[model samples]
Target: MTTYAKIIVNGSPITKSNFKLHNINGRAILPSNSGKYHDRYALYEQEIALIARNQNPDIVLEESLIAILKVYYKSEKRHPDTINITKSIFDGIEKSGLIINDAQITRIIVEEYYDKQNPRFELELFGESEYEINYSINKKSIIDNPKLYFPIKKNILKRDSDKNIDKNINSNKNTVTNKNICAICNNEIKTKDYMTADGGKTLICKKCFNKLF
Candidate 1:
């Protein structure tokens, strides 16, 4: 299990929902933010990028990822929604070039706590290899439908009476000799490494397919 980076950015976490509507050409359009929130949000993203680069100077993850985010508020007044903060955090990570893209993140864990003296955001990132190990270890306890992770394992479909069933299926369905790009994640993948979905109208890598459906 590899931990890619752990970054600490000091400030109150800002939700992506901090946007205001503007009346342009007699129509209301929502821009990125209002007056004060815009400057604050931009500074927040910049802080995240700078800290992430300093933490993992030479590392940029390209694999599927998991992000653990913790936000410590300065007071007990009103805590923002944890889910709403993910967008800004992910966008900041992308700006930092810590990961190839935010789309690589497959799972996230969010937590909020009160700390009157210190307000900050902590982020921890893990790659796909780590996720796989944890998934296998906690499969029974964590997931209600484990098949979603391993939809096409050979041992699950193997039969004592017929040893050629797995071979036959592989030869017929997954024996493409060319490499193709996944439609969902836009990652290059070997055709034989995965399968098509949505009635053969879309080609998705196993990781993206599993993450999606």
Candidate 2:
């Protein structure tokens, strides 16, 4: 029921302390000035943006997520714990519009390693969904079955259309007023709720297509 994605950076991992907070007029404030972690934050921002842009179906969010961490250190040195570093990481993810809030994370798995050469943290954000798993299996089955292949599918559609000419005529009149039937689920599909594939031939509802394809 879990789906995850990995995050990689061109440079080292940014620790919590690397983000500075100065007291301006007796109040703690976060400044946008460049610092040692500037490069790292830039990379984080770019990576987050990349992930957000290429979301599977480009919409829908998994309410519950779990983040697994593998922090790689360049050398044997004292640093903040992975748990402590999580706040900044989660904040970056949210800032990039990945999740509604970091509070949606149900669990955390943290591990550290000595990388000596390449210093970076590997983050895997897992989403809990049983439907995504089943959808993958079903899609694979459809691809593997030659008898139920797309050509056969088109023939089946043709046969069904031949038998439903009167219904089709009536449905066409109401399509604009009622709902556009989804090609996949045969359910009433709203314009925004349906996605088209194969240059507009294959239509699927958002609920069935959300981040699965």
> Residues 123-206, candidate 2, lDDT per residue (tens digit)?
777786521222122445344534342322344343444211224335656643334565444666655645554333345466
**What lDDT does each candidate get?**
0.65, 0.54
The 10-residue segment with the lowest total lDDT in model 1: 22-31
The lDDT, on a scale of 0 to 1, for candidate 2 is 0.54
- Check candidate 2 and list the clashing pairs: none
Q: How far is candidate 1 from the true structure (C-alpha RMSD, Å)?
A: 19.7
lDDT of 1 by residue, 1-213 (tens): 244788888877786465432221333222223232234666677778888888889888888988888889887566676778888788788989888899988888788887877888898888867554343334365557432333445676535543112223356566634336665455667545554433333354667544532
> When superposed on Cα atoms, how far off is each prediction in RMSD?
19.7, 23.3
Q: Which candidate ranks first by TM-score, i.e. highest?
A: 1
Q: What value does the lDDT take at residue 130 in candidate 1?
A: 58
Off by over 4 Å in 2: 1-3, 17-29, 34-60, 131-213
